[model samples]
Target: MSATRRQVLARTGAVAGIAFTGSLTELFAGTAAAKGMGRAGYGPLVPDPKGLLDLPKGFRYRVLSREGDRMLSGEGEVPSNHDGMAAFGGRRGQVHLVRNHENRTDAEIRVPAVRGLTYDPEGLGGCTALTLDSANRVLGERVAIAGTSTNCAGGPTPWGTWLTCEETEDKAGTNGYTKDHGFIFEVDPTNPHRTGAVPLKAMGRFQHEAVAIDPRNGVVYETEDAFERPFGLFYRFLPVKPRGGLGSLRAGGSLQAMRVPGVPDLSAIQETGAAFDRVEWVDVPDPLAAETPIRFQDFGPKGITHAQKLEGCYWGGSSVYFVSSFARSNEGSAADHYGQIWRYDPARRRLTLVVVFGPDTDVQLPGEEPDNICLAPSGGLMVAEDGEGAQHVFGVTTRGEVYPMARGRQNIGTPEEPAWGEFAGICFSPDYDTMFVNCYTPGTTFAVTGPWHR
Candidate 1:
C-alpha cells in the first residue's frame, strides 16, 4: 500500500506510463508526459483547472448536466444520483445523451410525476435526455421517463434507444409504492415526449443491473445486481420474433437464466483461471416474478447457476464481457475475489474468466471493483471503479494490463475536500470524438474530448 503510483504499476506488472502524482488530481497530467505510456492509452490524466474531473494532458471535459439543474420541461429540477448512460449521434453535429437517475423514493429530488406515465407516484427514479452540440455544450435537457424505482445501469440498443433497468425488487404497496417496481423501461432519445412509460416485463423482474444485446441475433443479455443469499443470475431474452426491435421485446420474449452444463452451483468458479463447462439456458417461467425473487427460484441453484454481485456488461468483439464486484470467501460464495471480469461467447457457448483482480490490500486499479464498462475503439476497455479506494476509470489493454484513465476531482465541501465518488456510465459518442461519463454524486455528466487513439 505504500508503493507510489509508479511503484504500484512496476510491482503489479500494470501497463507502463502510469505516473505518480502525489495527489489524484495530478494523475493523468504526469501520465501524458511519461515516456512509456505508448499508444495504448491517453497518457496520465491532467487535473481539471476547475477541479471537476482529472484527465490526461490535452484532454478536457465540459460539464453537460448536473443533479439539481433546471429542467427544460420546467416540471422539476434534474434528479440526483445519476447512474448509467448512453450517447447517440443526432442530426446537425449534435448528440443525444440518455441518462439514468438512480433515485429511491427518499432521493433529494424527484423526476416529478406526470400522471399516467408514472409507475409509482412516490418513486423518484427514471431517465433523462439531454441534447449536446458538436462542442459538447448542452442545448436542452428534459425528463424522458419518471415514476420508476432505482433506474440503474441499462444498455444501448442497436436500433437507437436506451434501456433503463431498475436495481430494486421492491414490491408494490410497500414503501408507499402502489405498483410493482422491478422492470426494464425503454426510452427513445430522439423524442422523450412519449405518451406513457413501457416497462419490458418480459425481460424478467429481478434486481436488474445492466444489459447488453448481441448484434448478430438481437438477443438481450441481462445482469442481475442482487447480492444477498442466492446472489444473482445472468439472464437472456429471446424475442419471439427475431429483429423485431423494441416492439418485439414488448410482444413478449422468452426469459432464460444462464447455467453451466453439469456444475449445479457457482462454487465451480473459485479459482483465478477457472473455466466453466458450456453454458445452458434454462427457461424462466414467470418473467414478472410477482412473488419469489427470480434468483431464489428452483431454477436458480438447480437449473441455473448464480454469481455474487454481477454488475456491468458490454458486447464487444463478438463476445459479452461482464463484472462480478467484491466477492469474498466469508460471503459464503465460491471465491474470495475483489473483482472478476468474465467473457461469454454465445457462438461457442462458453464462459471464461478474462480478468481476475486482487490479492492486495490496497485495492488496485484496473482490477478494483469494476462497475460499468465500455470497449474502447482503441483496442482496450474502459472500466469504472466503484471500489473502497479513490475511484477511477481504469483502462485495461487487450492483454489485461490496467492503467488509471481518469479520476473524480470535484470539490463538494471545502477547497481541500475532494468528492471521490464512483464513476458510472462510461461510454463513447457515436462519432467517437467524445467520451461521456458520470460522477455519481451531486450528479455530474462530463463530455471529455482529447487526443484519443481512435
Candidate 2:
C-alpha cells in the first residue's frame, strides 16, 4: 500500500487504551536504574514495545494535569487541545509552566482572566500557568491568564517570558476585537500583574505556529502553520536596535519574509546544495495591513516551495532550524506528503537541508506530517509526529539516529476495548533528565523519565 493510503488506514484503526499495571512498576524502578544505565543512551522510552502508553523497564509517566482541571486561582478548570509549553523557575521550590490551549471561540476553555485581561470566560483557547515539584509533580495551578483565540504554538523569550501565538486568521464577530488573529502575546510567569495578555502587533500577522528568539541579537524567527494550498511563509523580525530587548519587539521593528534568490522554485534546487542561496528580506509596510512581507515566490529542485507550511522553529548554536511538514521527496511522493528540516545559518546567511523525510532507508515510519519540535539536551532533535497510524514522538540525533520516544494511549469511551496512538509536544525539562509530552486528540500531558538506554 502507498504511504498515504497506509496512513489513512492507520488513522482509522488507531485505538486509545490506558495501561495502568506496567506504568506503576516503571515509575518506581525508573530512578534507581538510571545510575547504572551507562551514559544514558537514547531509545524508545515507551514501556510497551508493541505500542502503548506504557514505558520501558525502568521508566514511568504521570499526567501532571489534564484539561478541565480546576486551578488554585479559583478559576474553574483547564480547557482542551493543549499545545506548546514553556517552563520557568518559580520563586519557591516550584517551577512554573506556561501552557497554550489551541481552541477556538466555538470551543472555549472558560477561565477567569488575570486582572486587565479580557476573556470569553467560556473559551478553551487560552494560556495556563502551573507550578510543579522537582519530580515533575503538579504542586498548584492557576489560570495564569486568559482571553485569546486559537493559541497554537509559541516560543520562550530570553527575558524569561512566554510568547504565546494565535494560529488563526478568523477575525470576525466575538473574535474581531483583536486587530488581527495572527499575533504574539507576552506572558510573565513571575509577575502576572505587569504582563497582562496583549497581542504584539509589531510582529506581522500570519498563521504563526512557533517563534524562536535569538539571544545574541533580539531577532525573532517565526514559522507559519498552513498546509492547505499555496502554503505559508517563513519570517524574521529584526528590532530597530541590533541588541534590543524583548520589550523592544512591542515598539516595532522590521518584519521580513524569507525568499531564496535565483531559486525561483524550491523543487528545482532540492538536490543542489545551493550554497548560501542568497536570502532576500522584504519589508512590511504595515504589519497589520494583511500584507505578506515576502517579496519573492519560488521553489527549489525537490518541488518544495521556498516556505511551504513552516511549522515548528528553534534556534540552536548559531543557526535557526525550521521544519516544512509537507515537502515532497525523491521517492514515491505520497498523497499527504513527506516533510523536511532546513537550517538557516546567520553567519553564512544560507539555508541548508539538514534532514529530508520519506523513502529513507533508515527510519521507515510511513506518513509525512510533522508538528512542534525542540532540541533534545542530549544532542539531537525531538519532533512531534502528526501523521496517521499511531502518532509518535520521534527523536532524530545529529548523527541521524531516529528513536520513538512515546506513544499515545487513550480510552475510546469503551470499557470492553480501548485504543492507543501517537503523541506530540515532546519537551525536556531544564535539567533534561525529565521529559514532558503532550497528547493532542486526548488532550493530556505526561512526564516521562527513568534509566534510559539506547
Candidate 3:
C-alpha cells in the first residue's frame, strides 16, 4: 500500500480549512513554550518491539481489524484504504463505528457490495460499519454503504449518522460509473435500515474531502479536496429541515461557498494573526456540477476563496475547525507552508487564523501537512500528520505545545524499500476511554488507550 496523500493526490486532488483566534507559533513565541515543542508531548515514545506502532511510555494499541481479515458478516474481506471514521454508542453497551474505504474501481479489496446497502453496482469505494463491545473487541462488521467511488472522509451528524463524502469528480460514463460519483451519502450507525443507498444531491457535487456539522443549527460545513488549478473551496450547507432529528439532511438543502472579500487564495494570508471579520458566502451556481464543479463555478466579480488540499473539519465548542494540508507556489497557491489550521465561528461569521505550520520547517517534523484533526477530550487538539520521512500523530496542547503522540513503525514495504503508513480516522469512543484510528495502508484499525488526560 502506498501513501494516501500521494495516492489520493496522484489520482485526484487534496486540501484543508478552519480558523482560530491566533497562530500557535505566535502564541508559543510570546510565551515560554518552544515553537514546535517535540519534547513537551506525552513524554518520549517507547518503541514497539513488534514493529507495529510506537507510543508514549504508558500508552498501548491493539489491532482490531485488518484488510485481509474476513468480516463477521461473511460478506467479504475488509476493504483497502481505510480513511475517515466516527464512533457512536449503541444499545446493549456496544459501540458502533462507521468507517470509510477510499478505494476506486481498480482496488483489489473493495467494500463488499452487499445487496441492499450498495448505491452503485459498478463503483468500488464505500463504507463499512463495525460494532465493538465495551472491552474493545469487534462484535460485527458489515457494509454500511457501498457502490460509491472514493469515499475518503465524512462528518458525523448531530442526530446520529455519518455523512460520507466522495473525494472525486468522476462522471458517469468516464470510468464505467453508472451514476455521478462526487456526492455525499448518509450512513446510519445503529440502524442500517435507515441508511438506504441514497445520495444527498442537494449538498452539492464536487471533490469533497470532509464535512463538519453545527449542532445548534444543523448547518453543515464542507471541505473540498480538489487539486485542479484553482484548487478547492470551503462550503456551507443549510439544510431545509435543520437538525429536527435523524434523516433531516435528506429533506433538501442550499449550498454556498465561502468568499473572503478581496482574498482569492487562502494561502495568501501569511501572517498568523490575520482575521476575516466580514466573511461572506455566495450561492453555488451549480451544486450538482452538471457542467462545472463548485470550485470552478463563477462567483461574480468578488469571487470565492480557494485553498489547496482542504482535508478535514470537526466541531469544537461553538467553532467549526478545518485544515489545509500544504501549499506550494509552483502548484498555483499564493504561498508555501507545511500546513494551517483555522477556526470558523459560524455564529459571529468570523474566520480566524489559529495555528500555522511555517513553510521553512523540517520535512520530518510534527507540523508537516496536518490531516484529519479532532478536538482532544482533554483540552487542545489531536492532529494526524501526512508528511514525508517519519509519519506521526501529533498533539497540540492548549499552551501551544507540539508533541508526538504516536509514530508508525509498520514497514508495509520490503526490507530494501521501506514504507511507513499514515494514521487516519483519529476518533475516540463515545466513552472517551479508547481512541479508534486507522492505518491507511494495509488497512488496520487500532484501539488505543493510555493517559490521554495527562
Candidate 4:
C-alpha cells in the first residue's frame, strides 16, 4: 500500500515529535543526496554576483521592488522595513500582493493621506498593494492603507484580505498623535482605490504578531510578539455569530488564551521531543482592555501561559502551525532552545511540538530563529531565518530533511553591515511557480523561480 504524506513524515520523526540529537547539517544526512548537491534541496547554493542573495542551482531571482523607488500610484516613495505579505489572484492573469511596512515611527517615505483611509495622520506604518502578471512580473504598486502603527506579520483571511497586525501595545497620547497602536487592520487587495481601512477592534488588542484562521469554524488563532515582563500569549478568537461569516470578526468575538492542562509553566517544553498536553482556552475578561493593556490583565492566578517570542503562524492540514522564535533559560522558564514549532489541532484540542531546532552547534542548517514560515506549493515548508548569524531561507521536507534554499549576501560597500539581515515577508505567487520574499534592510523584494519540486 502507498503511504500517505503524513505517514511518511511520521516515519522520519518529522510529525511524530521524536527527539533528535545531531548537528544541524546532520539533520538531513538520512535523506538521499544527489551528486555534489545538498541533502534535501536542489544541490548547493550558488552565490550571486550582485552580493544580494544566493540560491540553489537552477533557481534565479529578480528584484520586484526597492525601498526608495517611487510608488506606482505616483503618491509617495515606497516605505522601508517590509514585513508580512500575501498574494491574491487578480483580473486577466494578474496577481495582487498585499505587503506590510513595519514602521513604528516616521519612516523614509510616508503613505499619502487619503480621506477615510487614514487612521492617524502621524502614524508611520501601513501596507502596500502590488499588481503583477501571471509570469510574476511586477506591473504596478500603490498604498492600500496608511497611518497605522508597527504593521507587523499578519495572515491572509479566507475572505480575500490581508489582516495586517500591529506588533505594539502603545496607547493613545503615549507616542505623538492620537489613537491606540496595537490593532489588527484589514486591507482589501482587490480594490486598491477603495479606502476606509477598518481596524478589527473586536479582536483583542495586544502585541499581535501573526494570525491563522480555521476555515472550518471561523476561529482565528493569534500569536503575540512581546518583550515585556509577561512575554507573549497564544490566543484564539471565536466569532460569536458563526453565520455572519468573515464580517463577524469586526462585529465581535470571545477572546481566549491557551493553557496546557497540568503544566503550570511553558518552560516545561524545553526538550527536543517536548510533547504538549491537552490544551484549554480560558476566557479573557476584557478582550479590548480599553483601560489597560491586555497582556497584563490577570486572567486568573495561573494567567495565560506565555511563550518566549511567539512569531510566525500559518494554517496547514487541519492544524495551526506557529513558531516560538526562541526560548531560553530566562526568568520565566528553565529550558533554553533555539526554536520550536508547535502544532495545534483545533478538532482534537491537541498541541504538540512537531520540530525543534537542535543546539547552536548545528551550524550547517543555522536557522537559529525561524520566522515567517509558509507552505511550499509542491510540498514541505519554507522558513525565513531571523537569527544573529548569517541568515538564509531554510527548506524543511516532509521527512524532516533541512537544507538551505537562499542566503543573504548584502553588498559590503553598502551602509548596512554584511554580517546579518533577515529574510521576511515570504509568500508564493498565486500560480505557485514563483516565490516572493523580502530582505529587511536596504529593503529589496525578490521573485524567485525555478524547478520548485525538483
- Clashes (backbone N, CA, C under 3 Å), per candidate, total 9, 33, 17, 1
Task: Give per-residue lDDT, candidate 2, residue 330.
Answer: 34
Alpha-carbon lDDT, every model? 0.75, 0.62, 0.80, 0.74
Model 4 residue 94 distance off true place after TM-score fit, in angstroms:
1.4
Query: Compared with the true structure, what per-residue lDDT tens digits does model 2 show for residues 1-454?
Result: 2434433434443222211111111111223221222232343343454333655456777778776667666767766777888777755556778888787765645445556664444444767777788877787777655767778789888888888887876553545444346678888766665667667877866677898887888888988775444556677898776565545567777877676765533433443233555676665555664444222233333232345557788776677777777654332222333566677887677887655555343233443556777666555556776765445665554444455555565643344433433465566666667777777555677778874333
Relative to the true structure, candidate 4 reaches a TM of 0.87
lDDT of 3 by residue, 1-454 (tens): 1354433322221112122335554323222222233334677677789977878889999898989899999999999999999999987778999999999878879887888888889888999889999888889988899999999999998788899999999988978998888999999987776878899999988999999888888899999998767899999999999854777788998999999888889988877667888899889999999998778788998888999999988776678878898888998999887778777888789887777764232332235678988766564567887865456777776665556677777777766656777789999887678888899987889989997656
What TM-score goes with each of the models? 0.87, 0.80, 0.90, 0.87
Residues 128-159, model 1: lDDT tens digits:
88998888888888888889999989998898
Clashes by residue pair, model 4: 24-362
Model 1 TM-score (2 dp): 0.87
Native RMSD of candidate 3 (Å)? 5.8
The regions of model 2 sitting more than 4 angstroms off are 1-52, 91-93, 111-114, 119-124, 174-179, 241-246, 264-269, 272-274, 290-306, 328-337, 359-364, 411-422, 452-454
Give candidate 3 misplaced runs (Cα > 4 Å): 1-39, 359-366
For residues 200-312, could you state the per-residue lDDT of candidate 4 as single tens digits? Answer: 88788889999998888888899998876577889998888655444456777788999886665465675444566578899887877788777778777765678878999
